[model samples]
Target: MRSLRQTTARWLAAAFLAGAALAVQAADPAPIELAAGVYMVPGTGGEPDPANLGRTGNAGFIVGPRGVLAIDTGTSYRHGQALLAAIRGVTDQPVRLAIVTHTRQEFLFGAAAFREQKIPVAMHQAAADLMATRCDTCLKTLRSLLGEDAMQGSAMFTPDIVFTDPLALDAAALIGRPIQLLHYGHSSGPGDIAVYDPRTRTLFAGGLLEARRIPDVGDSDLPRWREALRNLQALPVEVIVPGHGPAGDKRLITQVERYLDQLTARARALVNAGAPLSEVADATAMPEFATWDQYETTHRRNAAIVYLRYEREQLVK
Candidate 1:
């Protein structure tokens, strides 16, 4: 009976290994048409793994009358190039502008590819400042997280133009429409921007909302992020191209808001209850959130950030 038990354990271990191997070999994101000429490539998995190479962030493009407007460049050179190929597969039109919504390494690193195409990159001024000042640290951390091979040939490039105010753009002109870059003020990150296209009624909300993934609070001001979501809730867009995962709708924004609210409310409760920052993750663990990707890896960090935020707010008061 002992020998049989040992054999059963070995079989289980082998099966688990097989499953992990299959998951590691998962495929890259494929572009899906969000609207008539608006296309978004939905990302797979969570976080940067050797398999996904941190391609978990969504990148999109719009076929405008004048030229194509590439949304985020993606995480690396090859990923950016693959997106370019996908853009070509749709239309042979020239790409005009690449607008970034955040200062995250994954999205900003791919700007080099667009620059090579002679297409200028643009970003919110706050994002430009953050990236410009922290480029070296971001690159070093990314190299560690994504592995050298995935980051190979990738370089961080700041936007050519930095805008402090909302810009009127015609990237959707190819489809005979106009799109605007809207900044709703400090959510998700300091310079989170949303690409709003009234034609198809789609909003490319970069890093502002990651449907199906835990909202990253690493660099976010929770209250500000919630406020941003509230602003998004008022938008009339039918479809939202999130920073991560598939293209979704207002429900995505709603869902993210709920999660943010819950995280804040729950974390605040724990902190008030005298729970240690280190223990808040377990104390506030939501069964409903158990199935979410990267929960185990990131939940504690989220709790810790909220705890620190609470501490800081008290100090300010």
Candidate 2:
């Protein structure tokens, strides 16, 4: 097991280089109280976590008179604990519940820190199923990439609460914080759940909204994703928390919406033109986000996803 610091250092180096080359340096860790009871935990400049390295870990806290409601755990168990500790330092209130915004390995694995508290860790049914089946593989890959200890302890995480549609939790009751689970179809993951705190106007937007780096289109439905972004924009969101990147403003939602719109159009054009996969991959260019650090790698992957979707559509038709 590599020491956590070592892993951090290595990732930092990678992040620095990637950011510099792309001109997207890590933003400082700026913790902001977005809503009356919500706070945004930003990430410092450095290599991003292996799961979503380009974007910062957009974790947040929802505090009420009762206790704290953790939005999404950070990249590693260590990061999650740090986030947890940060919450504790601010308030002595117990952490009542943790709502995972999606199934991304980084966001879900941090549940270990609060395991002993027996807090109800909840995730969408699709997310829970993915974790149950592929967690071991994810753990092995993470250990190889981030070192064994870079993770919390175990990759096994089961959501105590699972629901298909929107579920509400009252923060005052300690039953859990009042959150609306909107599982938009194949947005970030198969089960992308967005947690909205009306009181805070803070939206924990899993992987749905990538602020800068080319939006990860993997497992994304281009049409639905574009629609989801528009829907998100319609919400009363002041502070936006992304799954992999820093806390953002409404601009994050706008950027993702544009990316989805343009990428789908470009990919569809290429497919209709009878372009090959390699041709489509090479021909596609991310719209006007080249300088947004970490765009190179993620852009390639995004284009690949677009190409794949186009091919899939052809087969279906």
Top candidate by TM-score: 1
Q: What is candidate 2's lDDT per residue for 49-106, written digit by digit as tens?
A: 5543422456777787778878777556666666777787677878888888776655
TM-score of each: 0.86, 0.81
Query: Which runs of model 1 end up more than 4 angstroms from their true locations?
Result: 1-29, 145-147, 168-176
- Compared with the true structure, the alpha-carbon lDDT of candidate 1 equals 0.74
- Error (Å) of candidate 1 at residue 154 is 1.3
> In the order shown, what is each candidate's alpha-carbon RMSD?
10.1, 8.3
Superposed by TM-score, candidate 1 places the C-alpha of residue 246 at a distance from the truth, in angstroms, of 2.0
**Model 2 misplacement above 4 A:** 1-30, 44-56, 168-172, 175-179
Q: Which ten residues in a row have the lowest lDDT in candidate 2?
A: 21-30
Q: How many residue pairs of model 2 clash at the backbone? A: 7
> In candidate 1, where is summed lDDT lowest over 10 consecutive residues?
14-23
